[model samples]
Target: MATRLQSKWFRDNSRLQHCLVSDPHHVLRGATGEHVSLIQGALSILDGSRIADDEQKRHLYGPTTENAVLEYKKRRRIINLLYQTQADAIVGKMTIRRLDEEMKAQERSRSHLMFAVGVSLPEPRMVILSETANRDFVGWANQMVKLYSGKVVKVDAATDPAEEVKRIRQAVNTAGAGGLLILSVGHGVCIPQFGEQGTFDLAPNAAMRVLGKNYNENEPKDFVSPYYDDKPAANTGLKPLSQKDKDERDQTPGAQRRLKNWALWQEVCKIFVDGKLSAVVLLTCRIGGAPLFLQKIAGQWRTKMIAYKDQVGCYQTASGRFRTILGKDKDKTAPPPPPHTNTPWGEITIPLSMTDMVVIDPPAAPKTP
Candidate 1:
């Protein structure tokens, strides 16, 4: 688990030694890290700039950092309340204090962090959601990071899946007894049934590149932008995992513990946050394939959960409405079943929204005459 930025503040912080402040006791231009990096971090949180967290370059009060400081002060009206003046473009004492206070509150709220598939949703929009989900994830997050301008940690869970769990649990613990609506978008191995939801065998993730859009910090309008990173190739279809390698990894206890929900979300909910979440929608493949899986999960959670049992895709309409489409689903989509309380998988609900999303109290099957 990462230490909250506020925890990193306070007197005698070892990292604080990198940057220094003068008589006015504020961080300004030309000064580099004694705590300039930390100042940049706080400004990023306060103003939602894509400032690099803890990097050496972030230690300098560059033009971007200066602008962020100005924006943050303006937003908070961090004027010298005593003098009733306007905000300025400096990390003075008031700005630092305000940043610290804001970050403290931020760490205690619902926050977002993600790494996208590519930078943006691909063109034509016929591609499977797996290819585009991360793009949306990154896009939504980018928009959110700026709009809300909270403490957003930009990291790909692929490198440190455990870290994500820890971070989530910490955020949940600090959210002050409020329910969270969670939407997770990514690829998952389709589960045929409930008990067979093996996390490891299902753990392989689609290749993840750097922090997306070449680290584009700006929020997007329609989640559509040119890919600054390596664009995804056409659907060559997934290469099957070999049996021997799968067996070996599954046998390892440690590997099983680090299960990826791109198969089952239970590992994180049960182990980390203990159901602090209210609603969870996993936009992965074949989640609805096993009705019993969601049934078991719903019994545990207080709020609703939703998921798709089909290999989903994002389709953009001619009028520019981007939504999940039934046309793209080839095999993973389930067929509509007989009218009953127990919803059978297959037969998609038609023109679904956003990456064959699933989870929640699915509508009860209608009563047959």
Candidate 2:
């Protein structure tokens, strides 16, 4: 039920004659009549000569006629360097005005639409854990940012979960509205409860440990410091933990630090669900049961969500191995395969305009995590 403009009525009314095109003087309509000939003549004049054949011009304003008008508009736009003109496939006054303008002048002047290409427009933003800022992840994030002309914000692994959420909220606010927010998390763990939606934690395993001389005997030996290797020293002796110490360590405030996925979603909704963002891409592992929460929230805010279904590989392959796989003498100028082939990963997209979610099952293999 799109609104249609009655160009014939406007042409008949003297009051609306000012809005009609003077050059070629035609009232274009979507029906079969003599007005179609006038439209064809106007299109032909705009093209600098006759474009449509006589037989085609005499026909109704069907798909072929519409396509011809569109082709003429496209060619004129290219030749005249016009950017702001709408390509509505209709011969209107604005189209006539654009055709009358000097091509040289169009080239010399920048359209107001062209001036706002990258500036003052919303750009994608990313937040990643410092612990997971490996070479592969950082390179991939940089590539995505460049691809979308976006911005990136890094979250420190050492920051408390609450403070981390605050930092992320601040980053989303800084990113502004009408853009995508990519949250790349690492070492996520899912905690499940019976008859309840599970919660996903984004705390890296390396952060759940005691550091330096402040080692707790109750803490698990499985915890390793990311900064240094565990080597036996004369002053510091590694000892087995007692049952009491283990219980105490489990109950410790720091030991229980984990980012709840639901809580993270709530925080993100508070900051970004202002009906401004286009979408949120959650690039994390084991995003189980979170899509439901996201869908409910997205429905309320009229935003979209893109979530991964399983673990995404973020580590880079060795240089030697990579070269072997791609062949050392491969042609650099050759085009890569199409993106829709050999699907492996899965993604779910919840569009703002639709009630049902769209699931891209086994989508093209991810180029980067």
Model-by-model lDDT, in order?
Answer: 0.39, 0.38
Q: How many residue pairs clash in each candidate at the backbone level? A: 21, 0
**Candidate 2 residue lDDT tens string, 145-165:** 342232444544433555556
After superposition, which runs of candidate 2 have C-alpha atoms over 4 Å from their true positions?
Answer: 1-135, 145-159, 187-196, 202-268, 286-290, 297-302, 317-369
Please provide, for model 1 over 1-369, each residue's C-alpha lDDT reduced to its tens digit, 9 standing for 90 to 100: 122224323323333322223325566666664366556544543454765333323346677777777877788787877766787786655665556566555434423111011111111111111122355444433433343433322223332344444544444443323233233335544345443241111111433211112222232211111122123454668644432235345745433332232122344435323534444445455655555445444544443555565554443323332334332433222232111111111111122322344445524435799
Which 10 successive residues of model 1 have the least lDDT summed? 115-124
- Report the lDDT of model 2 for residue 178: 56
Q: What TM-score, computed on C-alpha atoms, does each candidate reach?
A: 0.32, 0.35
- Report clash pairs, candidate 2: none
On lDDT, the leading prediction is 1
